[model samples]
Target: MVALTDEEKAMRDGRDGDAVAAAMDLLIRYADALGAEQLCETRNVAGTNTQPSPAKTKLFEEGGWSKAFSVISLDCDDDIEVPQMKVPTCQLQHGFGNDALGIMPYSERNIELQAGAESFYSSKGVNVLATCTPYQVGNLPTYGEHIAWMESSAVVYANSVLGARTNCEGGASTGSASITGRIPCWGNHLVENRYGTHLIESGLRMTGFQDWGMFGYFVGDMVQEARPVMIGDLGQPDLADLKHFGAAAASSGGVEMYHIPGRTPDAPTLEAAFGGAAPPESLHYGEAERRAIYDSLNSIGNSEDVDFVLIGCPHASLEQIGRVARALEGRTLSAGTELWVMTPRALRAVSDRNGWTATIERAGGRVLTDSCPAMSRVAPAGTKVFATDSAKQAHYLPAILGIEAWFGTTEECVEAAVTGRWRGSLAPAAVVR
Candidate 1:
């Protein structure tokens, strides 16, 4: 077992008094849980916020979280008006309740709980903006710097794309890291730990949204439990495609880290990401593989029955939103259908200013920000049948909602929403014999 240092011991034992002391205590325990050898100071955290549970509330009153929460910056906050979910409780050992789950059943009591929780963090000076992309905020720690992040896309982006280091974090560990300004020097921190273990060779010329998302799921499915460095004759994929792949891979096979050769920073070339270690396995991805991946992940059905259609899982990029607006031109969604396009709130505002939001809304789609069906757990609860373009959403909805969710291309989802039934083919053209 990795041992905590004297400073960590004092903090855990509450010898340092309040505020910073309480925060350090949590960080030490979190590091200990991960068997981390030492702490790395963290400058940022990205995740959702919730109402304080009984233990957390008590701690706030008696300990220093009340003070610590006042100063930290949180990427997102929980809302009582949105849908609620039953999730494994996060940091603070908050009990499993709507308050802890940060879901909506917003009676006056629940509202009070939500407010009380917000007050604790608000009093601590944490930014209460409801968002997932904190890198958009400001002064993001540069590549190779240590960060603590919980949002899947941000974690991958920081590690694989931006060249920063962090592990797949939780809210509790994040909060603890924020308080102590340090995280265990583990996972992505070590240079040796960042090397790729799996090799992905792509034959398809993947460029657009659907292709990218499907390709990501393909790679993720094939490279389970391995860090993949994608290498091939593949051309540059857009940021939307990267987001789609990262989110899908994370959702599908627990791939919190991946390096795209020539695109990602750390892996300027395949050789560097590998660091001289030979890949244990190499998988080839082609049109057939993409179609097969889509077939495997996608529910085979033409029956629409879709009550909801969601487009953004990792938050739509500006270009993706523009494409959506262009595709939906002059088309109206079915009156009964609910369509949501999610993006980072800041980006959403930019779209709103540029008239992309209106264009999408005019075509019967509403744009939401900082939250999605997966994180918000909103659409899945009341929804019987769900439709999304993201493999991540498709993969998680079944486990999270206990409902059958269908994965399709954005066009397929849009057409389904318009017709109140699936109008797309069960098999992609690449898969038909």
Candidate 2:
């Protein structure tokens, strides 16, 4: 272990007499676990969980733990009422939806308790924003810049995709890091730690959005914890596919970094991504791995009748939303089904300004904002079946919310919403070329 300076020792020993000392100690240890060399000042903090849960809000207010750090800005997937403000109204900059999965699993009373606890942060200048893509909100730190982030996909994307440095911090650690302006320079912060440890070889058979997504899940499961660089006859993937892959990777294996042979910014080639050093071992994925991934994560349709048809795991971009609206021209969601298209709040405004919102609403789908079903604490209750195009949601919803959920392509969900039942099987996306 490296020796700590007197000030660092004092910080660990509660020398400042601030309630944040214990939390800092925990962070330091966590950093050590990741084999970090030092600490770095952090900027831009983001969180996960639909809204503030009681466990999170309480630790911040009643636990004597809240005052430990001075975070400059905060963003998250849920919104909460803020109390007497001291810190600048935090930009509830980005968040996720509770509907992506169905609804939050907790009770309303518990949510109320969490809200009461979170009131303290507002008193210190926290804003309630329900968003998932904080990077879309200008909170992004540049490559090699340190940040305290709690969102799993964002942490992975930033570290592995953008070349920024951060660990998948918890809410409390994130809060304390922002307050202290310092985080253990561990994990993704160090260049040596970012090297690829595993090699993934895939044949070109896996194509289409769903195929690419399952490929990510397959790789995550095969490698377990090793950072892998993908190599093969793999074709190019777009942002939507990458976001889906990243979310699935985060869900399946808790991967902090990945190198895409030609896709990711940092990994223009396999050799470059691997740093000319050989991987510890190589793993190959063919049709068998692909089929296994689908079998493990695919959600079965519930009773051949669908109650809710949802889309937007990473928040559909304008073009995606437009594609749906055009296909849905003069069409309406079946009277029996409640169809909702979810997107980021700002993007919602953009859709409205561009008239896409009216077109979608006119098609019997509401363009909702602020939170997703997986991020929100509530949605229509007792829905027997839920449908989504996101494998990430399909993989986690059953355990997190205890509902019968199914995975499908965006078109399948749209058709289900249109007829109140699934009509078609998964189809490949038409070659965009």
Candidate 3:
């Protein structure tokens, strides 16, 4: 049984309102299920409460957003009035919105439903960041701060890159945490659980976005769900590089955390990554490993006729969007090809203000926000072979949509969108030891 504090008991015994009590009840059950001895305090939560689905629609019709949130988010059957979040909570990416109308196959009714959910949740103090990357849009949790976050890529980034503590929580757990500010103090919440389980080294220097992703895929395939500490002369990785790396790792091997000896916040040295213990025999990311990972990610593709190109997976940063715009500045997409740069609405606004959106639009590409083709399960009318710069998107879009995927660099993907052909190949760097 999980032990509860005085305040926890008060919430469980209905000292708080019905919604808060329901939230507390859900957290207790979740903690107990995880065999957690206690719950930790958290001030940050990232979850999805605005996504529209058939089940959520039915609940909404039955008792409005309150009923939907109570059942789906709080896991409660009671007709409870959802309250303002007790802690800071942000909504993750949801389904397509009005911006997607006529662009794809998403229905208007679902869009309306999602709009309603956004309005309702926003009124209840939910900061709708509406992207998988809450860190980019300023919902960044402080280092060592306990948080309740979902999205595997974000979880890994928080645990590995940002030095924050979080496990892979579900919508229910995050919703409950938002109201109660408590999460099960197990798994990644405890310091001992954050140590490296596998040691890895990369021989080829990684400076490009896709290089980090390929390296990540190799690591994840090797270590699976275990934490890995990477040590090598791999070149400096930027924000977007780590973003692709983490997302690809999560997609390929369900990696929730990793450490780069001197780069990441928590692991300042190789020894610290392993919690000061003797490090394990380091696995090498060499020529064979890089080739196999790249080929595996591109295995689903046989045709070269590209129809769609997706630029972002964890949502494109402002710099990525600008790069795409610059690449497409004076060019036009192929008559049959379409390209979309998925990003947060906040970044989209910035892109618009910076004229990047106009540049891409003039070149016949789009700067889209909030959702991606994979999340919405809708591409251009007849997309058979698609390409993406993101390894995570390349890994999943094939299985999710039954479409062929081409894994390539951002410039290559943009070139495909313009010429309607797949010319991307593994660079010579993949073979050099």
Pick the TM-score winner: 3
For model 1 the local lDDT of residue 267 reads 83
Between prediction 1 and prediction 3, the one with superior TM-score is 3
Give the alpha carbon lDDT tens digit for every residue of 1-433 in model 3: 8999999999888887998899989999999999999999999999999988789899999999999999999999999988889999999988988888888878889899999899999999999889999999988888999999999989999998999999999989999999999999999999999999999888788859989999988888899999988987887899899999999889889899899988999889988999999999989888778889989989999999999999989899888998999899889999999999999999999999999999999988888888888787889889999999898999888888999999999999999999999999988673334
lDDT of 1 by residue, 297-381 (tens): 7663344588778887766777767767777878888776777777666677888998988888887777776455655345623
Number of backbone clashes in candidate 2 = 32
User: What clash count does candidate 1 reach?
Assistant: 10
Clash pairs detected, candidate 1: 19-64, 69-124, 70-123, 70-124, 70-125, 71-124, 84-103, 91-172, 304-421, 304-422
TM-score for all predictions?
0.80, 0.81, 0.98
lDDT of 1 at 216: 74
**Candidate 3: C-alpha RMSD after superposition:** 1.2
lDDT of each residue in 1-433, candidate 2, tens digit only: 4345566677668665443455456567766776666777665566432255544444455433232122212222222222232212233323233323334343555455445534545555555555555565455568777777776777777877777887887755665554455667777777777878888877644466677777778777777666878877677776667767777788788887889867776677777787778655677777667656666765455476887776776566566677667767788888767766777677778889988888878877878766566664344566677777777777776666666676766777788888888664544422322
Our model 1 lands, by Cα RMSD against the true structure, at: 7.0
Deviation in Å, model 2, residue 395 alpha carbon: 0.6
Measured by TM-score, how close is model 1 to the native structure?
Answer: 0.80
- Model 2 alpha-carbon miss at residue 88, Å: 10
